[model samples]
Target: MTPQQRARFFDAAAVLFDLDGVLTPTAEIHMRAWSELFTAELARHGVQQQYTDEDYFRYVDGRPRYDGVQAVLQSRGIDLPYGDPSDAAGAETVCGLGNRKNAVFGETLEREGIAPYPGSLAVVDRLGMIGIPAAVVSSSKNARQVLEAAHLLDRFPVIVDGVVAADEGIAGKPAPDLFLTAAERLGVAPSHAIVVEDAVSGVAAGAAGGFALVVGVDRGVGAAALTDAGADVVVSDLAELLPAEAEKDGS
Candidate 1:
């Protein structure tokens, strides 16, 4: 990265990151779990349409679990009651389907452990060296578990995730509450902190929160889409934010 590009991050008071695609490859696991749940649910309901990756980016990715379930179900014109969070996995309700997906995710995670992306870890290390605090702001209830599995839980001192959002009545992404809350917890102003995310909804939340910088990591989502969603800058990996010399030194 150029000195100017690196300065954008080094000048920030703090950095807030989306846990899944940004820090770890768990987004792939999430996509698989969502596909498994929706494919079976659609098949059982005799729905003519099939679940696709497009559906994930459009309705599921980056949102709270039950909200994603509700959005996808609405697309298929299937209206299930918004069941209680404690509902059984197979129950015919929104929260039930979400819990079912979470079950699959847990099994997969346990069967095969996860690791943080090398590039993301590089950025985190660089940020820590520069004395900039960092936090995780994710829409997933499993954010803590994923971080622990990846051995990244200690890197982020503050995490604002789905459980906290639910308990505090904070709205999810595309509403700015999650990112704003993270900045607040970090004792940083929105205009002084940066948000790094791979999901369009997350980029929108950072933008809506008026953060200093909104960086979109294009794991799979197109650059154009992230730009349209309000990312101030877009890169394929977090390592690109570091100076070329710094990356080599870290290596």
Candidate 2:
């Protein structure tokens, strides 16, 4: 869809947003933590390979942690023990490695904190003005914490994040369950809801969910990659998508 088409779709029903790279400015932090943990883990096994920024967004940005571990390792043609979540952060098991990465991410969160993308927040505020409900679909168990840190928690009333997805056994992005759940919670039909995602897998999920609009937030990824992965519309930031409505209202 073009920006006009996307705007037409958002004129009614709801918008479901991916939390990390879409609403918050912490995608870089996640990429860093994942890179560090995976690098150290591979080193312990004497692999000595590198995990790049390209690797992080492609394999894990919107995914659950354990799933992310599997994805990245699979990308590298390496496999390790599926360690327990209870295992020490440095432990070599997959779960252990994931936990270690979380510890690193938590520390980073504490040190750097969370900041909502100004452009994305503008879009959300616009939705509020238009009386369109919007919620967040996140695969991070820390979604609430991240929102709180960013001080945008109250903006979304229906949150479908990692803990909810795991507890309900709903598959994550590229599967559509989380996004669908958000739409359901918002009492909106799939065709009436829009999904704004910044990750490739997330864009695929929104497409798979049959959302009326799958708007991609091209933070660092090129626009073509997001479109190829199934986004209906791609924008450099949310602000680009909001001015039309503001203009219509003389606001």
Candidate 3:
């Protein structure tokens, strides 16, 4: 979309955001952790082909942890039991591998910390200035920790994350349940709200929810792919979505 077109598009009553790649750079952290865990596990299983960043986009990105593990394994024609969430990291089950990945992610996050993407932060600040409510809706169970670590926890009043989804038995993205739940919590209809996401599955979720707008943030994921996934518009960065007048007003 053109700058003006994006500006008008985001003049929404509420905006639901996917936390990692959309608002922050933790997607890199997640990619790294997934690579580490899958590399080790695949090697242990004598799977010669490597797990690359491409796999993350294709199988893991934007989905719940266990679901991601299942998706990636399925790609290799590998199947494991879907163990309970409390399964140990070494249990050799889907949930176990997901938990192991989460462990690696948590350690990396604590050691290196995280920060919101500058462009995303700018757009969010501007939206706040205009009194448009925004909520964080992410597939990560660590969404709260990531937000709190970035000192952005208070900026978003509602968070619908993997933990909440699990507790509520809501299916993860590429389903609309989580986003729709957030919209309902915000007292806004899907048709009046916008969803900002940087993952294809997330864009699909937003589109499935029948939201007023589905904005795809291109952060490694191609703009064309995002558009194909049902994004109404795609921007190189959220900063591009900020209005010129808002930018002039210190946005």
Index of the highest-lDDT prediction: 1
True lDDT of residue 155, candidate 1:
92
Name the 10 consecutive residues with the lowest summed lDDT in model 2: 242-251
Task: Please give the distance, in angstroms, between residue 232's alpha carbon in candidate 1 and its true position after superposition.
Answer: 0.7
> lDDT of each structure?
0.94, 0.85, 0.91
State TM-scores per candidate. 0.98, 0.93, 0.97
Shift of residue 83 alpha carbon in model 2, Å: 2.8
Q: Give the candidates in order of lDDT, highest first.
A: 1, 3, 2
Ranking by TM-score: 1, 3, 2
**Number of the candidate with higher TM-score, 1 or 2:** 1
Candidate 2 Cα outliers beyond 4 Å, as residue runs:
1-3, 244-251
What ranges in model 3 sit over 4 Å off?
none
lDDT, candidate 3, 1-251, per-residue tens: 58666666567889999999989999999999999999998888888888999999999999999989999888877878999999999999999999999999999999999988888898888788779999999999999999999999999989999999999999999999999999999999999999999999999999999999999999998999899999988988888787777667767
lDDT of 2 by residue, 66-102 (tens): 9999988887778888977679977777888888888
Query: Candidate 2 local accuracy as lDDT?
Result: 0.85
